[model samples]
Target: MSTQRKIVFDAIGSVTTEQYDDPHAALEPGQVRVAAKYIGICGSDLHVLAGGHPFAQPPTVPGHEICAEVTEVGPEVEGVEVGDHVVVDPIMACGHCRACLAGRYNLCEPPMVAGFRAPGFGRTSQVVPARNLHIAPRDLPWQVLAFAEPATCARHCVGRLPESARENVLVIGAGTIGLSVIQALRIMGAGQITSVDLDPTKRQLAATLGADRTFAPGELDPAETFTGVIDVVAAQATLTEACTRVVAGGTVVVMGVPSGPREIPLPSMQRFERDLVSSGMYVPSDFADAIAWLADGRFDAARLVTDVFSLEDAPKAYARAQEPDSIKVLISLSD
Candidate 1:
């Protein structure tokens, strides 16, 4: 039997690498065994490591943003084949759920998100449902393919904005998701995008990636308002600021996963007809669009990847990812 190496969050502030029997030997029908190429360290992964995630706790494997090469396909798998480079759509939904029935699996109740609610692709190899694999262009770098998940999320979040709110957009947070949001807005034809981040480096990167304006958190004018506001840093302060800074009839898209319960300006929202919407994980179409955008050069995938570490150095990668200067940190599992 082959062995696989995986990184696990043992507890708060603890990360460990362990070896396990490869599951590829028992791959079931409709499943594909993939050799992980690159796995991204997401904000949610950090939250889990800090014991702040609402749904995910420690003693779990953590890696959801994945780019892998298919090594083998099970009996019923057809579209995906060996030698294909694919991005894993980590959202696992039960087919019977109402949300899944409506093709809104991202909203499925108690959904099992790979690396959070379920085992993820943090290991050397993973057996995933073939349906979850999005065949990526062979020519795209694995680092670029690794961004499909975040880009899919950004696409979905931007799609949630009302047409009226798309004219003038303000994105809070210039991290991976925030930068992706800016790119998505531009590709979707939004006008006048502005970004806010605490890190000047991130702010500059935001401007480079299609944001018309970038500002440090404190530098933004309090009196200015935007037709749409996307809060990628869902902290209480950021949420309040986002709600207040949106135009009276505008929409605020909450894209960040809050660490804990937080309050919004409900009274103001009611008074002004301001819409508040939450973007959960993305749907299939969003993933497809993200891949298409990345393949067509609409999204600058390489720029988002700020750091890469070998799988053996995943703990260090996590620490580096937490640094303010790091945007997207990836663990390279294979060439």
Candidate 2:
């Protein structure tokens, strides 16, 4: 049997690339085999690498932002065919669940998400459900296609805001998601977009990505308010600041995964009549829109990719992803 290279985590805070015999098995019905090309490193992957993420278990592959070329399709697969480039939506919602039936699959009681709870896409070749793959523009760089997932996540965060918040938006944390939010808001024709972060590099990148202004955490006026305040870093301090700085009747969208239990000031929120919503996985429509946005060249998605590594350098890729200065790190399986 031929061998293929893959990154694997055997225990918490451990990572390694190993060559294993190719499965070379026939495609199961409704599945498509992809020659995985690029996989973007995500904060969730870093969390799992650091032994902190609750959903990820050891002895699993750890990547979700994927771009690949379809090499084979199962008998029943219809939309995807060989030679097509695509991005995979890793959200694996059980269609029969009440939340899914109600069109809120992101809120499924027992969450089953790829790269988080289920098997991930961090390998040379992978077989995924046909429904999870969305066709990509063959012309776009593989790195840009790899961003469809995170961009879809950003779309979900901004989509949850109220109509009033779309005009004047404040985004916290100029990380990948934060930068994605800036671009998404720009595409949506937002009025004023201000990004807040401690890192000057990220702040500058945010401004380039369409933020009207970029400020360090301490530079923003505590008394200043906006129609929408998105806290991408959902720690207690940031959450408190978001609730405090939001205008009365405005919306506060929490997109970050809180490190632990958080206490929201119910009295302040009630008094101001402010709205708060937590953002999670994107819906199917959001994924489609993300792919469309990338395909149409609505924004420079490639600008966000800061580093790339081969499959054998998976450990280095994760380390670079953990750096505060790094915008995006990707594993290039093909290139």
| Model number with the top lDDT | 1
Q: What shift in Å separates residue 69 of candidate 2 from its native position after superposition?
A: 0.8
| Model 1 misplaced stretches (Cα beyond 4 Å) | none
Listed per model in order, the count of residue pairs whose N, CA or C atoms clash below 3 Å is: 0, 0
Model 2 Cα lDDT, one tens digit per residue, 290-314: 8888888886678888998988888
Clashing residue pairs, candidate 1?
none
lDDT of 1: 0.90
The TM-scores, one per candidate, come to 0.95, 0.96
What TM-score does structure 1 among the candidates reach? 0.95
